[model samples]
Target: MDIKSPLPFETSDKAHANLFNRMVNTLVENDNVLSQQIEGITNETLFILKGDQAIQDGSVSGEEYPIGITFMDIGQANDTGYPTRYGFVKNEKISNFRFVQYYYGTGNEAGNYFDSTGIWCRHWWTGSGWTDWHKLSGFLHTNIGTTGKQLLTKAEYQKVLFNRKIKDSHNNFDIKNNRFICPENGMYSVNAGVYIESFQRYANFELSIYLNGIRYKNIAHHRQRPESPSDTGILNTGLYGAANVPANKGDYLEIYIYANYEGDVSRYVSDKSGWFNYFDIMEIGGRNFPRV
Candidate 1:
């Protein structure tokens, strides 16, 4: 009678193969059907979840979503939610033994990937849940504050890491200690710049990024010598230095600056223009946190 329209296959024996392939294709077309596809999948098995979900044709009307695990946008598109979180999980239980969250950065304000918001990632070797997670975060701050007018003594060195005012995302940078605590073990970019002025000619100044209380040698630092104009305009020098270095959790960095002047002294001028004596620190997200 009706032999199921002859089922597209070489022979009746290949009908099962055709059925299996069609089933997989269907599973790859609609994420809504993911549950049915993985009904017999094992824990260690990995599968692609593809498809055009909102549309239907028993075929991918848009994006082809494979089956097994799904990278659903539970939150707003592009993770622009009041705050976006990223981590891998299978159904709620931990997958790849991780679950990281950020408490800071609102709606794409961005905290350079991982931020201070009590950021914690699951640690399978230790345990699970909220109590058993690892702290991984990024920090940002500047060297601007209250105390002003510090004329460097000849050949005097100092940690010019802070002014009288401050803004710390996670308390990672200690104004009191003049140190930036490494929030996580990863590659970081340390940068420093100062708005300086030399009343007399031939003023030599140095600004640097120090890691773990030691001088960072990766970035070669040259002395800054502000030129004395023959006219009434005072000479102002913008000193900048940066370095890319690896740091372990709890390791720290500092901004050290010095001046060796034979005639007049060098000074940390005012931040009237918003670009005076500042420092920047950022974790290399592309290197530290690879896409999961």
Candidate 2:
């Protein structure tokens, strides 16, 4: 560490005992290279580890090692403070994974558990053992605000209450039951939309995509007519769609709206600057469950 103590050994110059035996062998080779890099970081790379030091170093229930590189301060070990995590567990033949990666060290974010700072969670020893922290990044985008029209009916389908929440990283958007609740199992990537105010002539309009409540996906279907029998004028339309849905963990998603012109149709609140009626979900891909 910037070592330099050899200058004091000049007994009276005659190469001063061979420069004081090469400055005591360069201080015993820099003390054996700083004790083998501090014993490979305190015994094989555990540099600053501690969440009880993974069961005090035995490597969590020990089935055969594999638990180093941990760093936790969870507010000084569960004083219930929060922030500071960095883990990595592993363990095979019985599964056990871990992962973790946290931050948000200070400035007291004030919470009720939804500030994952740099978020990346994981956990997996299943059969009832360790399976809670599962946020591997899922997202949501919502929109809804209708103070006027909304009367659909080809005899059913009507659950598009998006309710407003733009960008939910892992809260899974459940604005009081206007659902989206899927937080694991993956493959999501849905995008939906709606905004039609009146189009009744041959009128068709349909936009669906609901999973836990069944109607799986009809994305959008619009059919308007007017340029024929002396048009009556009242036609505005918008329908959007995107899919890829596969979801699982508590699966729940919804967005419905039917039509065949059963009266009034959509546009309850537009002009609040924009966004007709939306719902975007995201989780791109992840699997390993009963999704075939």
Question: How high is the lDDT of residue 92 in model 1?
Answer: 23
Candidate 2 lDDT over 214-288, as tens digits, reads 888787788766655222456667888877778777888888877665344343313332366677776655452
lDDT of each: 0.50, 0.56
For TM-score, the strongest prediction is 1
Error of 1 at 141 (Å): 6.9
State how far residue 94 of model 1 sits from its true place (Å).
15
What is the Cα-based TM-score of model 2?
0.32
TM-score of every candidate: 0.49, 0.32
lDDT tens per residue, model 1, 7-105: 333446687878876876565556445555677575444432224431122111112333334333222235322223433222222343443322222
